[model samples]
Target: MKQQYTHTKLIELISNGGEDQENAIRWIYSKSGWVSIVKKMIRNLGGSNHDAEDIVQDGLINFIMDVQKGKIQKIEGANAYFIRSCKNNWLNNFNRKLKAREIIDREFNKEETSINEEKIFVSKEIWEHLDRLLEQIGRKCKEVLKLWSMGYSHEEIAKLINYENANVSKKTKSLCIEKLKNMGLNPDDWKY
Candidate 1:
């Protein structure tokens, strides 16, 4: 007869970082369905297989640290908790890449190869003005526009913001764009 180890027992081995840690981690990955959960989350977040693999590795490291530090007191439902942590880590990584892309786009879109101090100062003022404008448009409009600008699909945005449907997300985004246009926010103004 084969002996089956429960999740709590596996976590104890992992949390202890003993000689059995590697085996416990392997069992959790295989038996607890951690790999599939992370892969599905990464795919749904528009990430590739490589991203899923990376996120899974990062999540496991984070989970081990949390367990060792006594952050995860209970391990009976650790599989679900670990999946949630992986999803959060993937989302954080996704948002960071999006922000980096936005910054790169803005920097390269400018025609001049050499950036001057005056341009930097002017850019700061322009960004401050844009921030004030976004504040004026109200929180909901700002939230929707920010999500749209991050390249999320209407359905994804709807799910994130709790809208009724993708159509509502689209309509709300369009309305917000119209409001910004009405406020004299010329697209050309931000091109530099």
Candidate 2:
């Protein structure tokens, strides 16, 4: 018989990272019924097998990232969370494709038109700058900011990062945010 993983064991393995990270992902893929649910959702939406595979991959990556950053809250169970996340992602992708098709049809039917390419270029530049600023901050600061952005309580952050206490976690996160602001990064602009 195949081994089965409980929700608690899965969460511990995923959150722990390092050697456990790969195993956790493998367990998720191999042990859950959620994968079939995701595939069925996509198929019902007229997605091909390739699309199902892609959506599953993207969903897993997003779910893992959210888990690591502590963005997930109000957990009912691991299977439900994974299925919901994948369904949402697939729906979003389908909507984006519909919008793109509409835009392309409109463009083909119209003649030359004005587009504010400069504004887009400037926005891209600003984002690049922000990315650089984030990288400039030390690794620890980045970790703290990420966890805080993910909506982790100070106590939770402290336990995750091995800090002495919640107070220390709060102080460290505050200082990191301040440093980011001094370097021209608006804390409000960043999201997990």
Stretches > 4 Å off in candidate 1: 1-4, 74-76, 110-192
What's the count of clashing pairs in each model shown? Answer: 0, 0
Candidate 1 per-residue lDDT, tens place, 58-144, comes to: 888888777766667755578777899999988877765665565567667973333433343355577787787888898778888
Clashing pairs in 1: none
Number of the top-ranking candidate, with lDDT as the measure:
2
Of the candidates shown, which would achieve the greatest TM-score relative to the real structure? 2
Instruction: List runs of model 2 lying over 4 Å from the truth.
Output: 111-192
Model 2, 106-144: lDDT tens per residue?
668984433432223244466888889888888888888
Compute each candidate's TM-score over C-alphas.
0.53, 0.61
